[model samples]
Target: MSRMDHRNNRRKTWISRVSQYVDSSAGRISLTIALISIIGLYLYGREIRNKIAGVPTPSVVFRDKKRRRVLIIGGGYAGLLLAKALHHKLRDAPVHIEVLEARDKFYHNVASCRAVTEPGFGKQLWIPYDRFPVFVRRNCQVTDVHTNYVVTATNEEIPFDYLVLATGSINSIPSKFPITTASSQAVATLGRIQRSVAEAQHILIIGGGAAGCEIAGDIVDRYPSKRITIVEALATLLPGRAVTDEMRKVVTEKLARRAVEIVTGARVLLEDEEFELSGAGFPEPRRRVLFTDSGMALDSDLQIVCSGNLHYNGHCLQKLAHTHPTILDEHTHEVCVRKTLQLYDPMLPHIFAIGDVANCITSKTIVACEIQAKVAVQNLLVLLNAEFESGVGRDDLPARLKALVQVEPLQEFGVPGPLLFITLGRSDGAAQLPFLGVLGGWFMRRLKSQDGMTASWWRQLGYDNVLSNT
Candidate 1:
């Protein structure tokens, strides 16, 4: 009786399992089809966009016998990078290249903010113009880049055929590498910034973007005892951006923990000897402080303006974005290049714009700049070879909007890519990988950023190993 009962129970169990599998078959099949459709649509959409974008037909034959004359202007990350890509691509060919860079070295702009905290890296950040091949402009500045030659402030006319304008953004810091020239004047500027930071007790940093936030963190960490306050013009510290809530929380928490006060949703009115903000996130008025439409003074002992990059004066150097329609749009204010990244202008057939100099940017971090550099190089190679390619190049948005914007993403070097991994004092910090909602203390800062900060460009410039040995 027991054996018969056990056999009957086992048969019932097998029947139940078969019914469950049968019921789920349709759902699984539907899920698989949906996945395939999404991928196919993405690829098809990219192809359609490329065709609509209309890439330039290459003039230089990829395997041609003649040498390609490529002229790169301004040797920051953009110029140095393009030079490297050209080197690798034209390794076997006789490529006549000329890179026009003012000053002797490429200043590490990202690390410049870091210098406010750790004083040691300041001098090391500048690598001489001799680092890269072609023409070196030691103690020089670009006056003009006409159709045939590059004119310098010193009136030196260097001739070229193809042009790449990668002159990065200009910073106000003196010794920090000025946009033009290498002289005693730049030295005075560096001396002044250090003196200002050294003398101040209450520091006010305006604009909580990457520069402001990192600068605030660096300052507060370095001068722990100082009264450090950050006034963010936006409603939020890292507002509207896709940074992880945890990264924002961690950064806010870290700032609060260090007694660093953050005032969000305010506008800066004056950079008087004393720092001032309008309707600054503060509600009340303080005695002995002026109040405007915005709010009372943040009472800054020292004020550093991270008020975004100055673009108007940028043209005083080389006329880059002027002729290239791909750099910027005349009507909609968009990047006019295809995913292949060729400018809308028929003139700049194979060249591209990237890094801080890139227009229509939402994220201006070095991470985004690096991604642009890599893609610009890859796409440039394709252009040189008479083929078309596509890329996703959106900054600071969700994948849904990212798909809506639907540009190939440039590579980011930082860990998590949202919560900036930076060292405060002795490299103790929290980084928010907003994309992953992941947060960790000091791992990203010390490892990915601080220690991993190898100047890979040194090899490209043919300097680090060779220069060190000499």
Candidate 2:
């Protein structure tokens, strides 16, 4: 044997010994322990980072013999997040937080446009409430809200020490599902809409707001050869205080690039028009002519109404109008809330109104809901920990409630500012940031268009395993 052969033999012996050790039981146990230690360290580091960033973490909750009930109406984003935050903060306190939602599943309406336009996408958007960390009672409709209790549709009165009204608004289909819509029905509705869009050659979308633009964009993206028209009563595409002129121009241009026709300063006459074909033997939809106020005759096979005919879900508070006239806005029918997100009525200091239901001076968006939820949680905590005299009137208890925090309109702390991202299609979209100004298709695609942030939401609600299976 030469020197080189000897060196090779020594190297092979070392490899064989290491391989044999790795295959042994003791080595396997050591590897498992090392893996678990690494995972434990990673989780610990993540917890510390979350704490420093002001993110709430779930803790082991201890139940007291007598627990105070906290009832939340509408288990949408606002109500669900509020329940989670309260559960985290009051883990050791004798408090039971419950959310009452009419729908069986939590609908991610942010991606609703794509859900309607694309097949098999709706399933990911409809998340089951069973996986939610806090207690959420589904299919429970709140018929009325009283001072200390709420009346359910089933005629059961649920008493609560504190109540949160988060019943959001009801928009047109695809933008929002009906309050009574179950998970199966909602999925079927989205499938029907997808079929309708697929069959129609000329599709007309009423209202040039976010919903209309997104629907048109998604439809045209799926069916490029189809003619899609958007009609708005306003002069511009996106009309709101949050939308800048630059943002409007970019959205308009993006839609136009997709060959989506925009008809502004005109209203589609919806009354007394044969808008669709539905009778037997007419399996295929036929084109119908729709006249606008500006005498523009548009022919379309499908017409989607995304106009401002939204019904605010604050009517449940009408029962309290006899006592609190200003509880619900007479014009908008939105719940009138104070700056602290508490009910405007002094008699109902323990009741709060947040999200789209509350008449906050900001655009109704998820970001707004999140900011409002944080404020409501802070104020709720202050009230929960405060010492109140048994017979003290709410009006006289202002001194004790002085620590209640007020919401900063449109300002989510740690976030730059109000952010708006609109996806045109799978590959194209637009957005308006605080300091970044308006971004084009590339940025929007990477940010929201790919999976519509569905995975992030599932992960946020502690359903990461669902994503893996999907």
TM-score of each: 0.67, 0.79
lDDT of 1 by residue, 1-470 (tens): 69999999999999997667545866445544554464344324444565689943233343324454667666776667667756665666555766766766666566556556554445545555664555655555777655456788888887653456666654434212445444344333444565567667777766665566667767676777888777777766656354556666766777788998888877877534333221111111122232324866656556666655534223532365565434554443333444444444545454445555545233555555545555565554544343212222222123212232333342222211353454344455554443344435435443434522435544655666423522
Instruction: Provide the lDDT at 100 for model 1.
Output: 69
Clashing pairs in 2: none
Poorest stretch of ten by lDDT in candidate 2: 275-284
Q: Report model 2's TM-score to 2 decimal places.
A: 0.79
Q: Which segments of model 1 are wrong by more than 4 Å? A: 1-65, 118-120, 133-135, 146-149, 155-157, 171-177, 181-188, 240-242, 271-293, 312-338, 360-362, 387-422, 432-435, 448-470
Error of 2 at 466 (Å): 4.6
